[model samples]
Each structure stands twice: as structure tokens, then as C-alpha cells.
Target: MDVSKVRKDFHILEKRVRGKPIIYFDSACMALKPKQVIDAVNSYYNDFTACHGRSVHYFSAQTTEKYIEAHRKVERFIGAKENEVVFTKNCTEAINLVANGLKWEKGDRVITTKMEHNSNLIPWMKLAKERGVVHDYVEVDNEGKLDIEDLNAKLETKTKLVSLVYTSNVTGATLNASEVAKICHDAGAMLLLDGAQAVPHMKVDVKKTGVDFLAFSGHKMLGPSGTGALYGRLDLLKGMNQFIVGGETVKNTMLSSWEAEDSPAKFEAGLQDYAGMLGFGAAADYLMRLGMEEVHSYEKKLARKLYDGLKAIPQVTNIYGPSNPEERSALASFTLKGMNPQEVALILDESANIFVRSGMHCCHLYHQDVIHEMHGTIRPSLYIYNTDEELDKFFDALRNIAALA
Candidate 1:
């Protein structure tokens, strides 16, 4: 991939913040949207300002056509059919849909990993509380590497689903999707992947992997916020009940009985974010044009440099996850020997205009239980728009920050 050209697409990279250009290293939290996504969102408000479907007005027709195409585009982007993809408010909601929608009995069990974001972790816990279902975990090491043998041991006849992150947002460690899928399937359990961190940074083909469901957010992939998707196997989706019920979710209703719409429509309730959906499609298109394999390779090369630089800093105490960049996404979470993570983050921003994430990174279990760092670690995450020069500046700024340590 042309990294320079990719940086050009993100106009925010061109603008200065507080008298200095931004070296954004927080793509894991939310990716910087490109101009193409921005323009697509703008076109919705500027051109078509009408609701989709059940209307024959010109703008309404335009909205309907665009909405359908958006669905198809995202479906193609994820290697799923148009009918198999359901749009939700975010990945959290998408995960909740599967958690609640799937037919569950009192004794049923759900499995997830210790390294999950709260989005993937909580729903199963709630199910265990409210529905008398069993919720279990596939343990990970201190460095956030999942134990595959423990996963195989956890499966049982009662296990209904195995939900796990395809890639760790905090540590950047990746779960083996295909192997996990086979293990879960062999044990008669459906595998659900929290792909919020994986789908954006790498290629995730659902059919080839045989994962039953995947949930990911558009905002993490340069699409608009408040837009996310759940890709489910068609038969499985057809079997699920609607997670939410509202106007667009039903086909017809009666005083005594109601008929629900098909798979996606049945699951999507109320008015949808038509503009955000279009912008999401556009973002997928942008990534497709750039190529995901190329994106992965570029991030790997940059991450290796980042890993080496951080390792060279004498004040740096820990680098979370594996040392090999190719084994994980382009992210690093580390702690300074004598400095708080928040203090390090503040220094990086004030001194060099760098943006990084600090705190538990939404994985308190990993921090409090595994790494034993309650203050959390400073994380510098990268994307296609990030450059080697940015890494050089990051190292320079970090070295200066280390003097205080």
C-alpha cells in the first residue's frame, strides 16, 4: 500500500493541533475517518434527506436505493450475503442481539475469553444472572495469549456458544478463528467472534473460517459512529428471535398475534441511521480499494519498528502481548518504570502532540488480574494512515518523556 497516499486521504493529519501536527496513535479506540467517508456522509444530508422505504417521493426513493446498496456493500465487504448482515447501533448492541436472540434454556452455557472487552464479556454474565445460563471463560496468559487447549477442554454438551475476540484491542494478540471455530463446532457449540479489532485491520472471511457470528463497529474501521454490523449464518439468523421490536421490525400485527419481517429487518427495529450506513459502506469501499492484505503488511512493518523502539527505551518496563509484531495488530501497550501511564500520555500529548490511550483500556480483568497493573499501560496503536516518520517522532518524544522516569 501507498502509505503516503493513504495519509493524504485523512485530512485531519494535515491540520495542526496546538501549534503542532497530530501524530494520532489511537486507531484502536476509533480510527480516523478518511475524506471519502466524510464526503459520503455529507452527500446524504445534502442530497437525500428522506426516510427509506414506504415512500414514493424522489428523495425517499433515492434514500431507499442508497440504503439497500449500503447493506449490499457492507455484506460484500465482509464476505456475507445482504440478507445475512444486520445493522445495529454498535458492536455492543450487535453482540447483545446474539446473546439475547438465540434460544437459550436455563442450563445452557456460553464461553468467552478473559481478555474480552466488556461488550463481549458482560452479556453472557447477564445471561447467567437473569436466565440461569452458565457463563465461562477461556483463560489467557499474563501477556494476553489465549490457551487453545483450555478452550477445547471447556466445551461440553451444554455449551451453546463460544464468544471471543478475533483480536485484542488492548494487547493486539489475535485469536485463531479457524481453529477455534472447528473446536467449537466439533463440540456442538457455535463460535461468535468479537471482530471490532480484527475486521478493520485484517482480512476476516466468515465462510472460510466457519464462525457462526461476527460483531464489529464501523467507527473502528473509518466509518461513521453509531453504526455497526452482525454477520450471522443465514439459517442461524432465521432461527433467532428479534432482539428489539418496533415499527420496521414487523411485517404485520394483530390484536392477538403479530408477524415479523425477514432476518435482518426483523432484527433491526425503529428508524435506522441511513446516512451512517452509507458512510459505512463508503468506508468499506475505501478499504477494499486500498486492500486489506496490504494494510496488514504495512501495519506489521510499522509495528516492528514501534516494538523495537519501545524495547530500546530503558525506562519502559513492559510491552504487553507478544514481542513479534506480525503475531498481533499494530499496537503496543507498555508501562514506564517510574511514571504513571496517564502521566506518560499527558507528556506525549503536551510535548509532541501525540495521541495515545491510557488506563485499563476497557479490559480490567487483564490489567487487575493478569498483568497486576491497576494504573494500566500507555497504548500507541497504528493504522494505514500512520507513518514510519510518526514512529520516529513517537520514539523521540517517548525518549524525552523517559528522562522524567
Candidate 2:
């Protein structure tokens, strides 16, 4: 792949910030949109801006077609069936849809790991507390990788669901979903993955993993914000209750009697973000054209380079996952000794024109167990758009910051 040509597709990379070129390394939080995705969204608004699934008029039909086509794109991207994918506001909402929609009874157990983001953690935690269900956490080693032995031990007879983050947003630790799913199935528990950080940077085969459900956001995958999906097995979706019920989710209604729609449409309860959904389709197509294999390889090279460089700096404190780059995503989280992560991030932004994320990254419980300071870790997440040259600049800035310390 032509690196320069790929960079040109993102118009944001062409601009300068504070008279210096912007070096964005926060793609894990949200990826910069490409021109193709932008154009797709723009065209939707310009041509058809009507209510979907409501009317039989031309614009409404076009809107409905585009919205349903986006569902197909999401299904293809994640190796799920069209009826299995349910659109949500973001990954948080998608996770919540599963966590809350499921039939939870007293003595039921839900297992997750300490490495999970709050999106995956809090929803289950709330369910455990409110529904009198038991929640167990499979603790990770200091290296930020899950202890499979501990996980297996926790899979007791009562284990009802096993939620996991396929890739950590903080440490970039990638989990083996296939193995995890097998273990969960052996215990007769359903496996639901938080793919918010994994889907964009890695290749995901939900069928091969044998997971029963999965959720991911499109903003992190180069699409517009406020768009995400939840993939649930057809039978499971059929069994679960619809959390949100309104206009588009009902099949037929009377004053006191109403029938629910089919699997996905029943779950999607409101007038949807049609433009954003279509743009998500374009984003999926964009990544598919670039090839997920190439994206993974390119990102691994950059991750290892960043890891090695950070290790050489004495004042920089690195918190990484597995030792192998092939086992992780391009993102990394670290902190400068004696410096607040937010303070360091501010200095880098003001002095070096580099953008990075700082603080708990909404994974406070995980960081509280790992780092001394409970607030969070400074996260520098890389992506296909970021080049090695920008990473070098980041290293130079860190080195200079170390001198100040």
C-alpha cells in the first residue's frame, strides 16, 4: 500500500496546528474520517433527508434502503447475518442493550476481566447489583494479559454470561476470543465481546470465534460518531426482551395490544441516524478496500517501534500488554514519572502540536488496580493514518519532557 496516498485520504492530516503539523495518536478514542465517508454522508443529506421505514415516497424509500444497506455492510464487516445486527447509539449503548435485555435471575453469574473498559464493565456490574446476579472478574497479570487459568476456574455452573473486551483500549492487550468463547460455551455461558477497540484495528470473525454476541462503535473505525452495532445470535435475540420499544419496533398495535417487529427492527426503536449509518457503511467499505490484513501488519510495526522507543527512555513509565506486537493493537498507554498524565498531555499539545488522550479513558476500575494514581494513564493510540515520522516526534517530545523532570 502507498503510505502517502493513504494519508492523503484523510484531509485533517493536511492542516497545521499551532503552526506545526498535527500529530494525532488518539484513534482508539475516535478515528479521523476519510473523504469517502464524508462524501457519502454529505450526499445522503443533499439527496434524501426523509424518515426511514415510515413512508412509501421516493425520498423515504431511498432513506430506508440506505439505512438497511448500512445494516448489511455492518453484517458483512463483522461476519454476522443482517438480522443479527442491531444499531445502537455507540458501543456503550450496544453493550447495555445486551446486559439489560438479557433475562437475569438471582444466582446467575456473569464473568468478565479486569481489563474491560467501563462500557463493558459497568453495565454488567449494574445488572449484578440490581437483579441479584453474581458477577466475577477474571483478574489479569501485571503484564495486562488475562490469566486463562483464573478465567477457567471462575466459570462455575451458574455462569450465565462472559463479557470481554477483544482488545484493551488502555494497554492494547488483545484477547483470544476463539479460546475464550470455547471456554464459555463449555461452561454453558454466552460470550459477548466489546469490539470497540478491536474491530477497527484488527480482523474479527465472529463466526470463527464462536461468540454469541458482539458490540462495536463506528466512530473508532473511521465512521461518524453516534453510530454502533450489536451482533446477537438470532435465537438469543428472539429470546431476549427489547429494551427500547417505540415507533419502528412494533409490528401491529391496538390500544391495549401491540406485537413486536422482527429481531433487528424490534431492537432498533426510533427514527435512526440514517446519514451516519450510511457513512458507517462507507467506512466499512473503505477499510475493506484497504484490506484488514495490511492494516494489522502496518499497525504492528508501529506499535513495536513505539514500545521499544518508550522502553529506552528512563523517565517514561510504560504500561503495555503482551510482549509480542503481533498479540496487540497499535495503541499503548504510559505515564511520565512524577507527572500527571493530563499535565503531560497538555505539554505535548502546547509544545509539540501532538494530540493524545490522558486520564482513566473510562476504565477507572482497571487503572485503579494497575497504576498507583487512580485518575488514569496517558494513552497514545496509533492508527493507519499515523506515520513513523510523527512517532519520532512524539519520542523527541517525551525525551525533552524527561529532561525537564
Best prediction by lDDT: 1
Q: Backbone clash tally for model 2?
A: 0
User: What is the C-alpha local distance difference test score of candidate 1?
Assistant: 0.90
The top-ranked prediction according to TM-score is: 1
Model 2 ranges with Cα > 4 A deviation: none
Q: Which stretches of candidate 1 lie over 4 Å from their true place?
A: none
Task: Give one digit per residue, the lDDT tens place, for model 2 in 44-112.
Answer: 899989999899999999999888898898889888876889988899999999987898889999988
Q: What are the per-model C-alpha RMSD values against the true structure?
A: 1.0, 1.1
Consecutive 10-residue window with the lowest summed lDDT within model 1: 321-330
* Cα shift from native, residue 104, model 1 (Å): 0.8
TM-score of structure candidate 2? 0.98
lDDT of model 1, residue 149: 86
Residue-wise C-alpha lDDT for candidate 1, range 1-405, written one tens digit per residue? 988888888999989989879999998888999999999998999998898887899999999899889888888888897699999988999999999899999999999887889899889999999999999988887668889888889899999999998899888899788888999999999999999999998888898888999999999999998889999999999999888898888899999878999989899888789889999999999999988888888888987898888888889888998766668678988999889999999999998999999999898877887788899999999999998899999999988888976
